[model samples]
Target: MKTELVQTFGSRFERSLIEEIADIGTWMEVPAGETLMDIGNYIRQIPLLISGVIKVLREDEDSDELLLYYLEQGETCSVTMSCCLGQSKSEIRAVTETDATIVMVPVQKMEEWMAKYKGWRSYILESYHHRLNELLHTVDNIAFKNLDERLMEYLKKKSEISEDNNIRNTHQEIAVDLHTSRVVVSRLLKRLEKMKKLQLHRNYIQILDL
Candidate 1:
């Protein structure tokens, strides 16, 4: 648990808070494709992801799991402050991508720890601020930038496979990130492919001819 927490959040804190949380934390082992939470569920506890990745999804009124963001090991599940402070329920879903171990700290227990331990308090506060900044960056990117520029930047930053004239990113994943329809992305890809700027293949995209 200590190693997982340290690996995810970084090891700048002393051992006391980690030890304390470990004492009360309940271990949850979840299987792949499991939906941990649905929209309108009040997640009173926070899951500290110890292993594997969870997709954080949101749905439209039509109830589709439109992928919002993903949380992997070391990230906390659910942006609960919106639900915690305002709405009674969260419009979010957490789906497991692999067998995972999550340490669930009950809200009351977390509050108690925060009050009693300065280190824990500091960590939570810092984590919240960091998440807030990330949210702001996303908001700015979506609101201020053109889609093409945003797409390019997102690909450059998030694409795992990149070479001088090629990048590999999944179309479905890019559409989710771009908050656009897959058809739109497909059209754009075709245009780029026609220009000899990229090539879209099964499960992968390649940049071509620079």
Candidate 2:
């Protein structure tokens, strides 16, 4: 655990802080497709990613999910941080995009570390800044971009984050993340395939152009 913590956060976090995390934080290994967090769940801990990726999403009025952002190694969920500090329920959902390892930091220690560890404080603030920018980008994508363009961006992000151009995600899964229907996703995917932008398999997509 110490080694993983150091490998993930060594450069930015103080050694003492890293040691503290290794000692106190609960180590967890989650498989792909696992829901690490869900909307309305109590937020008592914030996860520090050690490996793999987590996609965060927000639910709409009809309970459809819209992708917010992806959290990668060494990064924590800013929304989780806010909810933890406020002692409120989680507003967004976090799911593992692939097999993942993480350290769960108890929210009870947040205040102590904020006052005691400059690195921790900076990390929290910086996470907020970064996630805020991502939220704005999501807003712009929704407001200004066409569905096809948004779909391409979504595929690009999935490919890049998982480092696999041959994405094994189902059309219905993609539709859920994009806040659309399976029929719409299937139609758009076939259109993209006709344009030679991608290859649509029985259950997966292979990126050919974009």
Candidate 3:
């Protein structure tokens, strides 16, 4: 667990800080294709991803839609400030894309830590900053980026996690992330595959080139 925390947050802290959190929380495993959070759910808890990935999604009023974004290890599902400040009920839907393990921390326990641990406060502040930056980036991209560029950028980020360039993601998922139609994503992916830039297997994709 200490090793996982270091991998996520970097080794700027002594091991004791991570050990403190690990001591309290038991690991929970979530199977793929299960919904971890639904619309209008309480936000009094956050899960620390330890393995595999989860997809954060929200659907339109029609309910025949999805907004998919990959939430990998180390990313918290609950946006802490929103929940802490008593904002709207969380609209985000958290669904596991792969079998996953997460350490769930209740809000009350988090508050206690925030009050007691000076170093932990710094960690939370850093997390807030990073999350804010990411949100800003998402906003900027949606306003200015084209679908192709967004898809390419997503692939690039995914490639970093998977050294072999394997991006085991679906076109429908990519469509949601890019805010485009699945047909468009499918067409583009087919072109890329034909160019020999990637290998497409059942429910998985691997980038052979850039």
Off by over 4 Å in 2: none
Query: Which 10 consecutive residues of model 2 have the lowest summed lDDT?
Result: 201-210
- Candidate 2 residue-wise lDDT, 64-125, digit = tens: 89999999999999899888888889999999998999999899988999999999999889
Give the lowest summed-lDDT range of ten residues in model 3: 8-17
Q: Each model's TM-score, in the order given?
A: 0.73, 0.96, 0.77
RMSD of each: 4.2, 1.1, 3.3
TM-score, candidate number 2? 0.96
Enumerate clash totals for all models, in the order shown.
Answer: 3, 0, 0
Higher-TM-score candidate of 1 and 2:
2
In the range 1-210, model 1's lDDT, one tens digit per residue, is 667666655564457767756777787899877988778888677777788767666677755444445566666743764465454787777888567789887766666766787766676787677667766766788789977666666555434222234444467757865778778887777877787766777766765443
lDDT of each: 0.67, 0.91, 0.70
Kindly state the number of residue pairs that clash in model 1. 3
- Model 1, stretches more than 4 Å misplaced? 6-10, 29-33, 62-69, 81-87, 96-101, 156-173, 192-198, 207-210
